[model samples]
Structure formats: structure tokens, C-alpha cells
Target chain A: MATVEELKLRIRELENELIKSKQKQSDAEHHLRPKIDKMSAEVVDSNPYSRLMALKRMGIVQDYELLLFDYDKVELANMNRLFFQPHQAGLSKVEAAEHTLRNINPDVAFETHNYNITTMDNFTHFMNRISHGGLEEGKPVDLVLSCVDNFEARMAINTACNELGQIWMESGVSENAVSGHIQLIIPGETACFACAPPLVVAANIDEKTLKRDGVCAASLPTTMGVVAGLLVQNVLKYLLGFGTVSYYLGYNAMQDFFPSMAMKANPQCDDRHCRRQQDEYKKKEVERPKQEVVQEEEEVVHEDNEWGIELVSEVSEAELQDASGPVPDLPEGITVAYTIPEKDGASGETVEETDQSLEELMAQMRKM
Target chain B: MATVEELKLRIRELENELIKSKQKQSDAEHHLRPKIDKMSAEVVDSNPYSRLMALKRMGIVQDYELLLFDYDKVELANMNRLFFQPHQAGLSKVEAAEHTLRNINPDVAFETHNYNITTMDNFTHFMNRISHGGLEEGKPVDLVLSCVDNFEARMAINTACNELGQIWMESGVSENAVSGHIQLIIPGETACFACAPPLVVAANIDEKTLKRDGVCAASLPTTMGVVAGLLVQNVLKYLLGFGTVSYYLGYNAMQDFFPSMAMKANPQCDDRHCRRQQDEYKKKEVERPKQEVVQEEEEVVHEDNEWGIELVSEVSEAELQDASGPVPDLPEGITVAYTIPEKDGASGETVEETDQSLEELMAQMRKM
Candidate 1:
């Protein structure tokens, strides 16, 4: 048998060989791929942004830009989903995401923030960025997307958006990892996060108290991936103005059920900023110009018909308008579900009015 | 001013420095992530598979294993989507996927096939592997997932699965990249791909003729990611026996619509193997034991009530059975939609039977 010292020396030699082989492999990979300075739509194997640029060619989007924010570092647990790699465990999530995204599409400019948005200083900076961070400086951003997990982070976003009168979308996956949802928040036009607090918050319970030591919430890659995909798809639709942007969409994996509904903002919302935004939105609605309706002459399919058969539309104009027209303040396909009830019975408005309207809509849907 | 020769020398030196810096960065990354020998369920920052393994503890999946199949090499264009990286451009897709998947969860065993399955020789090999490639040797795989893009490859999988009586799921994205669908096939029990050929195939058009030179199909990362998410979610549900497995689910991103339906196997399928499997399934169904129903006594809630008021169920037993009972040869939630029309009009069966049932189901859905 070899001596312990000899064995130790042999182990060191093997370790050096392994390291050398790894270096060789890394060098080969680096040599194979060179960074491109611009995004190209060329139909070639080497154009990374070919498919994405095709979206612009197809007239699905005007232009796309990217920005990232995160207060946490990348962890190995994030690998179960997508994006982060095992080698990036010690890097900040925003830095890691920016690096990977830059490599994928170098044409897009990136700005990453690695601070907690809930903090007073960061929240002010976040609001400033949202107000004047467009492609053209001093202009507000087109939209905001919230993918934060905790209630506090969501509330922080809600408060900022409400104060700024910004449109945003929020997404979340259930703790059990079997369901998820994405909701659009149009400041005063739709229900903000503060307008309808979750049951835990409404009950005045500390959200932190729900956590237990040595126990973690369950998660799955499939649910998170689906939620992310849906959220991005919605973002594309809203930006491109090509599809019906959903107000609220939910997914239930257990039964493959998807429940969608729109909720109206509460008139008596607790947040003063939300109430102020609602008043401004109402003022804007009064000043908005009415759309003009144009009528087209009906085409005569058969100029000379022996039978003289006449064709008429089965759908009436009022019904057609109902199907396609925007509601009083909301967009088409978005109907008010209900408003949050006021606490302390301060407002004695009959709940029956909202309840009856929701029932009527559900009844109509059932009769469809 | 420097001479041309001196400038060239300076450029060469900078290039050398660039290469050295990249090498150092790669080495640091490699050292940070050591290969894990086993998957752990402990929720920690370092456990990559912690979230995935939680499924077992949550009683969703009993156990999971992975196998991959692909013939194409990775291209930079694929980086717009998830999974593949820029460094993996020249690598075979199956090999790259196996490398990434292995790093995510080292406990799972993987076997990758990197050849076209449509060829006669390779088809035989593929069938053989599917028949005896389970964790337990000599047994078939639990399920086969077909993510192939071409009609020829899909048909190849359809044929093999039909001949072997294996279960599989087929997924696809639309050519325009705005829609996608997932369909589950249980050999003879459901509609095989050959049983209902697409319109182009039914018209006997050469699929290759549809392609044009210097033009490529449109694709979006969001649509593809969503399709993949749905496909994997369905796979998890099928393998884990947790959720209701859908027979056919369609997604239209333009309208955010998800249309689901089920189709029964055709009696006059083009593939002879499918007919044989159908016969085998029918015989097996006859041989299978029927489940015995257990009746429970209703508990009295108002035992001491002098008013003699008693509560009764509003839903009848027949309605309950209709809602939950499995169809004769299909699972619950799977209803026969329509059969493919016979080319020669050999079968005298009326198309109205299938059409009326589908209409009734639609009517019921509208009423809900």
C-alpha cells in the first residue's frame, strides 16, 4: 500500500488535472461564441434575437426595452425554476439577470437596481425612476410589472403606482404551488392592491406571524413558469395594443380551471393617494373626447338575384355595442365585479346594487 | 502618431488580455458550484432541488425521473427561449438539455437519444428503448412525451405508441406563434394522431411544399414558454395522479382563450396498429373488475327539533353520477367530440350523433 503522504500528493495531482480540463472546456466555449453588438433578424443559426425581432416585423410590438430590480442574491433553489444558474449563486439576482439578458440581446439597454423598494430611500428613487425613466427622458414609463412575493413589497408597489397614477400588473403563484394569478392594476380605474386588502391584512393580523420556524412554503417550476409566461404575454398585449388585456386571470392546476373577473376600485379605499388618483381619473374621463361612429354601406353580394333573397345582420346594433364598447370607465371585456364594503358601517350604501349587477352579469354569461 | 504595425501589436495584446480575463472568470464560476451527488429536500440556499423534492413531501408526486430525446443541435437563435444557453450553441440539443437537467437535480437518472426517430432503423431502436427503458429494467417507460415539430416525427411517435399501447402527450405551437395546444393520447382509448389528420394532411398535400426559401416561421418566447409550461404541468399531473388530466387543451394568446375538448378513437383509423390496439383495449375493458359503490348513512343534524324540519340534498343521485362517473371506455372529463369522416363513405353511421353530443355539451357549458 502507498504511504499517506504519497496518497495525498496523488490526490493533489488529480485535482490539478481536473482543474486544467475544466479550464480547457471553458476556453473552448468562450472561443465558440462571440458577443454581437446589435440585434439582428437574420434567419441564421447565429442570430440570438432573430425570433424576438420577428415580433416587430410582424407588427406585434413597436419596440422593446428591459429593466431589472431585485433586493436578493441568486440562490441554488432558484435553479428549479428558470433563469438563474448554479454558478451564479453568490451574485445579486439583478446583476445575474442583467448579465444573462445582455448576452441574449445586447441591443436592448439595461438598468438594474439592487436595493429594497420597500425602504424609504429606495421607494423615493423607485418613484422617481417610474416618473421619468422612459426612452425619452422626463417622460413616465409605459407600464410597470410587479412580480414580488411578499405582501409588504406588493403594498409598496401599490402605494407608488397609486400616487403616480401609473398602470401596472401583478402576478403571484400560490404557496401550495398548484395555482397562480395575474391581475392588472390601472391605479384609480381598477382596484389597487390597497383598495382590497387580503383577508389576513383585513383581519389586522401580522403577516410575519404566519411564518413558522424550520418550515418553508412549497413551490414548483411548472406553476412559476406558467405564471411568468402569462404575465409576459399580457404585458406584450397591453404594450402592442393587439389583444384583449385581461383585468384579472387566475389558473387552477388541480382541475385545469381558469377563473377571470374584473374588480372595481373601492370609493372608500383606505389609501388617500388611491382616492386622489380616482378623482383625477374621473376628471380625465369627463374631459376625454367621445369616439365617432362611422357607418359603412352594405355590400351587395348578388347584384342581380333571381330569388330576391335579402341578407340581414342577426345581431342588433345595441347588442353589438354592448359586446364591443368600453364600459363607463373601464375597458371592453372588463366589467365591475363588486366594490369593497366600508368598515365601521360609515357608508350606508345598499350593497344590493353592486350585488345585483354582478349577478346579472353572471346570469348573462350563463345564458351565452 | 503610432505606426500601423504598432497599432496592430497593441490590438493583439488587448485581445490576449481579454482571453485571460474570460478564463479567470470561468474558473471562478466553476469553483463556486461543485457538483452535488444527491438531491436534498432541505429548504436551504444551496439545495437546487429543494423546491422540486418538496412535491414528494406535499404528496403530489411519488417520484420523478427524466429522459430526453432530440436530434437538432443548439443554435444561438434558441437563446430567445429558455433552457439553452449561448455557450451551448454548437452542442446537440439532447446533450445540452441533459447537462442542464443533471445540474439542476443530480439524483435523477437520464438517458438521452440524439438521432431522428422517424427513420426505419432508428424507429425500431426508439420503440425498443420505450418498451424497456424504465427505472426497473425490462419494463416500458411510464409515459412518452412528444415535443417534435414535424409531422413525420409526430407520426413516427404516434405509430410506435399505438403499436406498443403506450400513453403519450403531444404539444405544438402555431406557425404564427400566437397559439398552442396539448393533447393526451392513451393509445386506442383516445384519438391517435393518425385517426384525425390535419386539414392539409387530409387533403394529401406535401408538408414540405408549405415551406418557402429565405423565409422562416414566426416564433415568440412567451408563446413557447407558455406551451412548455402547460405541457410539463400536464405531464406532472399525469405522472403524479393529482389533477384532472385534460384530453385536449388549446390556448389562443390573442384572446387569452383556453378551449378544452376530448376526442374518441376513430373506428376507421388509417393506422392498422391503432385499430389493433383499440380491439385490445376493448377486450381489456371487459376483463377489468367493476368498482363497488359504498353507501353512507346520512347524519341527523336536528335530532331534538320539535318543529320536525329536515334538510335534504337538492342534487339527485343520477345527476351526481352523471357529473362524476367515468364514460364506458374513457376517464371523467373526457367526452367524445367527433370522429373523422370516412374517405370512401364505407361506414353508414350518421355524423349527427357526434355533432349533437358536442352541441349538448356546449349548451351545458353555456348554462353553467
Candidate 2:
């Protein structure tokens, strides 16, 4: 019934209204969550860092800072894992991660590297950053975390960390997506990635040959989330100097089995840098002071016993000795009920003994 | 300098350009990620569900559907954990979660409940939904997961599930933000939440009394993420019937210890519904068909050996017998080296023995 001119005007007005509404929505979102310049432990709904800062209050960690590095762009397929959103597709992974992490905790300064670390030029830059990138310039970073997918990238990190005598952690999820592992690598103290290559590489099999056309590795948010959680937990433990930091931790989702073991650095490691690090570590060990033993003083909770009552142990010393060998010294009121038998062989020695001569192992792998 | 009238006109034009650019940005974002109607395991960059559906291709899960329920709104403080965004602040958590999850997998249908399930009126509705909220109406859901933060909500879920004989998984993180646990609750089969209330509840202490003014419980993304990962992994295993489903799994981040154990249902559970479910389970157990044991047949890899060589184990029968007792039947070419001693007591019996009489435990707790 309306004229074409009038109808055209109405449509244009509707379009303008839609745009205005969209703008208002965006503005409202921004207004609701204003950029915070400082981290506060104040428990409030608006304080994004309150929960995180509570760790300090609870004496879990003294402090935490985050840095990100990646050369890949976010893809829709990555949605199966955590973090990135649909709208983030095509954005550089580092930039996207930084944006999300910044919104979560703006107080922490973030530096992102979007270049590949495998390149010779980038490797130099990476090394330079590791040496100088800290709260205080010229001081090396407290730790490095390697979450790269490929063995090549892992080897590059191993080389850099070994050369710098830096401590780092390596993490990975298996191609099947049901298993993952995180390992702490202290350059000279622990085995570097190169010390024992993965079977795929050690066997002299082309990694590419494992993949087929039109097929890609499966990934699940559950596996990645668990791995990331464990990695961060390990990082917190190492940095805060609390808990026994694991040398190697593995997760198998299928059986819900977590296997952990410590691996000593290989003296015959192929990497020359690793060998140099081992030498330096041996020299430093000699220079280090021996730990002083401190005697623990017992505290008297009740200086006066008005009731004149004393507590007695339920089990006799003879019975206790029968349960195990001579009991170790214990606190006044504490007594041991039982002692678990020692395992057959020391875990560390078993692992070491399992390895054949490096050349022989390599030869066997090559034949496979 | 421009005249006032000309300057005002120029300012208006610049404002128009700004709005136009914002509109364009919004349009581009929407265009880049079009809504997908079905899940596809095509291994392409544009398919959000490709990696998830690959779980099916890899035979991990037949299918996975998600449903969300929450009465709380998203707060900025939640940013410390995974999921949710800054702009999602003030939005209902279920709605926000639904939006995010929908974007990740559009093929799955989602239903969100925004009301508290503890309310009497809502509890009935909740139960009703649970009874008929399957892909096919009038059937129950495959599983229910409880990620609630409070004991009251957990009790509500437990009551509902017990009444319906529905199986569910319960997950929680400790207040200190360093430990967590997940339990699989099969009504009448495993211990229901009410069967043994938490120590605080059993001691008749008001849970609220444990909290201090101005000090909220601490939380960590790591703990929550790990708990969630374990929970969802359990869910997948239970649904897909691959790995053994853990009855109870506890995670202590400080020690990186994962303690697993199974608990039997308490005969004197407080909940009447639980008792009824127990009786029903007992009746069903008797009615269930006995398992059929199928003997495994060995496959002949080399039917024809031209060399006519006979394979013999290196260890003799006497040596093998010395290592352990009589060896169990094994396939040809398999030999036993050493056998691990079985742990002392049945794990289930040990847990049961550790628990004092419920009344005695309760009385002791109350005295504390």
C-alpha cells in the first residue's frame, strides 16, 4: 500500500536502528568490564584477579607472570580444545591468547612472540629474549615452558635451554588425544629432549609417513585441559618452591593412569651442548656448600601437669621392633604403626639399567 | 582555523565514519564464522566440530550432547578459570555457557535451566526434566554431572538422582584451591552423598560457620580445570564403554597424588529414597543374567614355518615356579619373569573397615 520511496526510507531507517543497537551492545559490554590496571586480592565480583591473587593469601605462590609464544593462527578446529572462540578464527594464536589472558589479568605484563622459533634468526632472538626477558632486564627468565607439538621444535628448545643452562618444562598430548605428558628439564641436572628421542624419531621413521591424506590427528578439550592444568600446577610448584616438582609426569586418559618417574641426564647424550652443561653442573656441584643439619627442638605444650597424668603407648617396644627394624627417632607422643616394604629395585636404577648402550639402542631402533 | 559551523559538520562526519567502521567490524566477524547446522569430521580449518567428531571416527565416543544448568550470572572473577569472557559479565552463566558451547558444536541440541534446583518447586521441575530430557522424549538422560560449589545443591542432585535411580558424577574442588575430587555415584550401588555426609555435616556443624567475614574461599583455574577434565573424561568412558570407570578419584595438587578407591553403599543411609533405590538395585542384581565366560582362542601368526624351528622360553619351569606359584595360563611364546605380590587386603574391604559404625562416627564427629 505504501509508495516505493516511502518503503525504501523505512528500510534504511531500520538498518540504521540495527547498527545503533549493535553499537550500544558493544558499548555496554565494554562498560561492564572496564580495563583494570592493578591486581587486587579484594574479594568482589568485578575483580578478575581476586581469585588468582588469593593464591598468595593462601601461601600457595608468591607471584605469577605469563608470557605467550606461537606461530600458528587459531582455527575453527581448535574449538575442540579450550581457550579460543569462534570469532577468533584466523587470528594469530599468540595475539589471541594474549588478548584473552590480558582481559583475565591485566595487572601482569605480557609479551608475545609470533615468529617461529625454529628459524636461525628467530632462534637468536629467542635466546636473547630468554636471557634478558624478566621483570628486571638482563636477568634470565626464571623458567621456560615448551608446549610445542613437533619433535623438531622440542629439540630446538632443548638446544637453547641446554646451551643457556636454563630450566624448562616440556608438555605434549599424544596424537590419539587420550594421553599426555609433562616433563621438567633442568639443563644439566635432568635429561634433555635430545638425550632420548621419541620412538618415531629414534626408529628413523619419517613422522610424516605416519599421517595419511584427508586424515588429521584427533584432539579433545579434556586431554588438553588436563595437560595444561598439570603443566601450570608443576610450574607453580617449581616457582613457589613448594611440593615435589616431578621430573616426568604422564597422563593416560583411557586408564586414568598417571605414571611419574625421574630421568637423570645421559652422560653420552648426542647433543654437545648437553655434555657441556653436564660438565658445568659437575663443577658447580663441587663448589656448592654442604647442607647443614639442624636439630629440631621439641616444644613443651604443657609446662605444668596439674592432673599428674601421663600418656602411654599402646604397643610395646618389642612389638614395634618385630613389625620392622629398629624404629627411627620420633616425636615424644608419636609412634609408628607399620612400615611399607621397600620395592624390589630402586626406581631410578631400574630406569637407567633398562637402557642399552646408546649406539645399540639406536641401532635397534633403526632396524625397527 | 575552520568556522564553528564547518567544524561541527566535520565532527558529525567523523562520528558517522566511526560508527560505520564498527558496523563493518561486527559484520566481518559474523561473516567469517557462519552458523553450522551439523557436525562434520572433515578435518578442515573452518569446521568447529571436526576435532570433536573425530572422537567418533577414532572410536572414543559414539556421540556427545551437552546440557547446561546454572542460576548464577557470569562474574569477572570467573576469568581466572577457563571459559567465559569479559563481555559475558552479567549474563546468566548457563546462557553464556550455552552460547560458547553452541558455537563449538552446533549439531548438538542444548537445553539450559536458569533456576536454582534446590527450590521445592524447581526441584520437581528439575526431576521432571531429568526423567524425560533424553534425545527421545520420556526417557532419562544418559548422565548427570554435578559441578555445584555447595553441599546443599549437591544434596539436591543426590536426592533427585537417588529417587530416579539415575547415575551421576560429582566433582568438587577444595576451598584452599589446591585439591579436588570426582566420584561416580550409581544410586544404591555406590555410596550416595547422604550415606556419609561430609565431616562438617556429620559433626552437626553449620557449614556457614566455617567461613569468616570478608574472606571468600580461594579457587584456582588449575584445580577446576583438572577436576573438569577428569569428570568429562569419566563421562566419556562411562558412555562409550571403553576404559574402566573410576568410582572415586581424588587429586592432591600439592603432592600430585591421584588416589583412587571404590566405596560401597552404606546400608543405613539417611535418605529414604536411597534405601528404596538400594532395595531396587538388589532385586535387579538378582534378576540380571549371569555373565558368560568365553575362552580366548589363540591365533596362529605363522601357520607354516619352513625353518621348522621350535620356540622355547629362556626361563625353565622350575625357575618360573620359584619366581611365583603356578603360572596362570598364557598364550604360546609368552613367559613370566617375576610376579608382583598382591596388596594386603581387598581395597573395598579396607575402605569399609576404616569406617566406624555410622552412629559411632557421627557421635565422635559431634564431640569434635
Candidate 3:
């Protein structure tokens, strides 16, 4: 049995130990909320990853809270399009978006890079340094997304992705803020940015130079949001392999037109890396196993011939030939042939059919 | 000559009054910083509306801060799609969004109405009360935006707008969350919401009932942003009379397709107010001057055909006749028809051509 004074001293020491333990538990929770386990879709305030986890619960993404976003600074204009708030007005966009994202789901591993993506050195450093863990295991970062505004930045991203033989997507909105486009680049498999330069570059005009003294390009949060949403949607599709991913998608908001087309990697691309990628793509095509072709049978379920009447097709060969020419008398406020001008010394059209064939062949192999 | 003690007392009293005045100034600033002057695009932290003011500088909007927005409660799931921040996790959506928007541009008028818009009385009272200022002399509110989620709210808004002859815009995202649409409604001039009910509403299914147990709709901030952008862009066009605003614009993210169509006020609409508007439109058309029709001349600029051959038109009467039927064998992943299923007792099709004629006549009158 201990004396009264000695027992009182032990009780005080135990209480101090309990206080230290409680502080340790709190510190652990503050630092490592989701570090211990996978994201949970619990609809509780304590669950930081509830929103992203909801994506999994909704069956949209297989693995929730796993996206790497690179944002630099949040301007006042960006507030309309992004989750950046007023209190975070002057903060780095990466930090602000990351803070919001973490609150959405802390399980998502978000790494930020605020360097200018337009510089070659910076681009290389970013691609290699950030993707060091994945690159070591032969797969580059699952996908690289280029949402940069300027041509130089796009070209830089294009070059880096080509050099690494990585898959990536590019998105942009027009200066008028009424249109936008998103395109996929599978290194050697698809057209690189240098393959067919945008009309702005082909017209020999710098996008930044187009801005007048006190006039900036019109931008809408709506266009940016749509583009971003589409970009992410395609990303999810590519990652989860569910829907048909558009190779190139364009948006004309004024008319609400979405035009899609696939581009072949230009053999005489300005970028040497693009040409090398094309060559590698060709070599791989030759090395792959013979692809099984699934013939689309023109089967008429109504084989009984109930009507006994042969109906001629709506469009004749002559009509089809006539339709091949440019359409005249477009409705008011509508324009046609808004295309990227061909590059000097480049073939007008070639290799697009071959690219499609190659894609089909890859699909067949995947099915096997 | 006053005594030294009296002078000292006066000085102390003045000092106390000055302190109170300083406190009042601070409080005034906290509550109303934008009530003083027009929105300024000054690039300063103190200026809350710089980004929106940039729109005026960019020549997009004549007045950057004059628009009104209504927001309600904010939720954790809303963080994925809106400007919800970490600190605003538990706050009402209206308060959080308003706090951020005011920070973006304090000049923009933001009014909050947290009650359910689907409630007929609440919607009517809300709309009437809010627009009393603008409706006093005949002109209704500049515009009303229905960003509510369900069909009941849409019908309620439509009824109120029709009753007041107010112009409004409707925006909605599809259940799959991959598509959305925005439409401009000019009350009497354009199609009312009841003219062509949405497929879901036409099916007579409750939107809230569509949700399964523990399952919520998948949404992206990108889509909502895009829709909002388009809505604001159209509002600017309608207010400033610059760009050609689409009456209806649909967005399909999966295929990056935008399908546009024009709907006219149905003469036999379920809503009696819509039928009255149509009758009024027809009466106005009769009262207006005859529109000058521009006949398309078949003038061949070239005396001789370039290829020494005649090119026959493709769309013959037979093809046109056949084209009206249901098209089979649409490209994979492309749905040919996305018709809004007709409601009970609704006509299959009627009065759309007349509506177009009315619109054309109105355009002609405006030109004259």
C-alpha cells in the first residue's frame, strides 16, 4: 500500500500521460486522415473523400480519388470557372485547388508543380521528376493533360509527351469564348500538335500578339468548365475503359455544334520527335499479330419480304458526288470549312485511313 | 473665454464621437462596399469585382456588375461541381457562393431565396416580390434564370414567367450527368416550358424518385460551369444585342455534340397562359407590316460550268420524302432522334412552322 501523498503524485503523472496520448491522436488525425486506408464513400461530414468516393459509389470511376492536377495561379477570372474562392484570391491556384480537392477526398494523392510548362527544361524536369516513381516501372504518369493557353506551352507539352512516348490530351477554348476543343494524343499513334499546327500558328500569328493594347480575349467560365468536364470525362473513360473516347472533339457554343475527326501523325511534322513517333508506330504495327476483322453484316431481320418492294437509297452516286463539294447557302450566322490550314511542304491528306486501320487492329487484339 | 476644464471636456467628447464614427465606417464597409459606384476593373485586392469588370474591358458586357444571381444551400457533394471551398463545407450554399461571388465582384447584385422553387405559392410570391421593382411600370425583370433541379420547379417557374410575361432561361443536366442544355425563353415570343415538356416529365415520373437507395447522380463541376457560362453569354447577348444567341443549345459531352433546335409557342399548349401568348403573337403579326422576302436567285456567276458539266441537286423530292421517315443504321454510339416524348393529350406536332414565320417577321420588323 502506498501513502496518500505518493498515490496523489502517481494520479497526476497518469493524467499527464493521458493528455499527451490525446494530443498524439489528434495530430495523427490532422496529418493522416486517409493515409491509413482506401477512400470510403461514407456520407458523413468526417469523411473528407465523400464527394470523390461518391463517384465510385455512382459507378463512374473504378478507383476513386486518384487524379493528378497541375494548376499554377488562380486569377480573378478563374473564379467563375474553377472552385477557387474569394478568400483564396491571391494564393497559388495549385494550393487552392488542392486544398479544396483534399477537403473533397483526402485519399487522392495530389502533387503540384507551379513551373512554366512552356520552357523545354522545365517541361522535361516536370515530366521526369513528377513521374519518377511510375516512369521507373515502365509506365509514365497514366495520362498527361495539357490545358495550357499559349502555343509554346502546348508545343512544349507535345514534345515532352512525344519524347516519353506517353499518352496525353489537349484542350483549348477560342478567344471569342464561344468555342473549345479537346483532342487525344497517343504519342506515335495519333497526330501530335506539330503534326498539323492550329490555324493561328498556320496563319503565322502569335495568339498572345492578337490581343490589342487594353483588350483581352473574352473568356467564359462556362466554356472552360465544359472543356474541363469533357476532358475529365474522357480521362475517366480511358482509365476505366467504358465509353467510346473521341479522338478529337470540338465545341461551337454559339450553334452548339460538336464536330469530331481523327488526324494522322504528319510524316513531315515540324517536330522531329513526332516523325520518330510515327516511324515507331509503323514498326510496332508490323510486329503485332495479324488482327481479326469483324465484318459488319448487313442483316435484314425482316427477311420474309412482306412488301416485295425494292426501295432505292435516298442518296445516289451522283448525289453523293455532288455532296462531296463544299455546301453553299449555309444558314445565316453559319460558316463552313473552318479548318486548320495545311503546313508548307506537307501532303494534303494521307495516312488517316491507315491510322484508323491500325486502331481497328489494336482493338481486335484487345478483344482476343 | 471658456474655462480650461470645459474645453478639455469638449475635446474628450469629440474624441469619443470620432471613435464611434470610425466604428460605423468600418461596419458600413463590411456590409456595403459596392453600393457606392459602378464596377471598376482595377487590379487590386481591395477591388472585389475586378474579374467581372475585366469582361467589360474585354468588351463582352456593357455592365459587368449588374447581373443578379440566386443561390441556396451548399452541400459536400456540390464541392465537385461548384465553387464550394473547404471552409464553406457546412455553410448554406447561397451564403458560400455569395461570399465568393461578392469577393469576385462586389458590384454584382446577389439576392438569396432559399425556399423551394417548386412550391407554387412560394415561387409566385418570390417572383412577384423580387420583380416588383422592375414590373411596376410594365417592364418585367431583365431576366430570370431557373437553375432548379426538378420538373416541378421548372413548371412553377414557367407558370410564373408566363403569368408575368417575363423572359427567363432554363438550364438542366441529364440524369447520367454527361449531358446538359440551356434555352432562352422570351415568354410570349418563344416557346414556354409547357409547350414541350421534357421526356422525363412527359413520362410522368418524379425526378426525386429516380434516385435509388444510397445512390446519387454523378455530376461534374465542368458541365455546370459550361452551362452557366453559356447562360451568361446569352444573357449578355440579349442585354447588349451583340452576338446571335441560340434559342436552344444542347451539350452531349460523350460525343462532344451540340444539337440545336428552335421551338415555337404551342397554340394548344396545356398551359392556358401559353395559348394566350400564342394568340397575342398571331395578333401582333397581323398588325405588323409585311416582311420583305429575299428570294434566293439561281445566278451562276460563271457563264460556262467550270467542269463543262451540269451538277444536279442532291436533295430531290423523293429523297426529302424518304428522309422524313425514321432513319435506320445510324453511326454507332450516335442516337438519331432524341425527341421529347409527348405528354398525354399533347399533339404529335403542330404550330412550329407558324412560330418560325412569326420569328422571321419579327426579325424583319427589327431590321426595318
Q: Largest DockQ belongs to which candidate?
A: 2
Model 1 Cα displacement at B163 (Å)? 0.3
Regions of candidate 3 where Cα sits further than 4 Å from its true position: A1-82, A130-139, A199-215, A293-368, B1-36, B39-72, B133-139, B199-213, B292-368
lDDT of 1 by residue, B197-301 (tens): 654444455667766554556677888888888999888776655555677777777656666666667667788999898898778766655441111100101
Best by TM-score: 2
Summing lDDT over every window of 10 consecutive residues in candidate 1 chain B, give the lowest-scoring window: B293-302
Q: Model 3: per-residue lDDT, tens digit, B164-249? A: 77788899875445567888886666677876664445445565655455544445555666676667666655654434466777
Give the winner by lDDT: 2 or 3. 2
Q: What is the lDDT of residue B168 in candidate 2?
A: 93
State residue B173's C-alpha deviation in candidate 3, in Å.
Answer: 1.5
lDDT string for model 1 (A65-173, tens) is 6667789998887877767877778899999998787666555678889999999999999999899887777888888999987878889999999999899999988
**What's the distance in Å from true for residue A5, model 3?**
32
Return the candidate ranking by lDDT, descending. Answer: 2, 1, 3
Off by over 4 Å in 2: A1-22, A32-38, A57-65, A292-368, B1-22, B28-38, B57-65, B289-368
Interface RMSD of 3: 19.4
Candidate maximizing lDDT? 2
| Model 1 clashing residue pairs (backbone) | none
lDDT of 2 at A288: 56
Q: Each candidate: what lDDT?
A: 0.65, 0.67, 0.55
Which consecutive 10 residues in model 3 chain B have the weakest lDDT in total?
B294-303
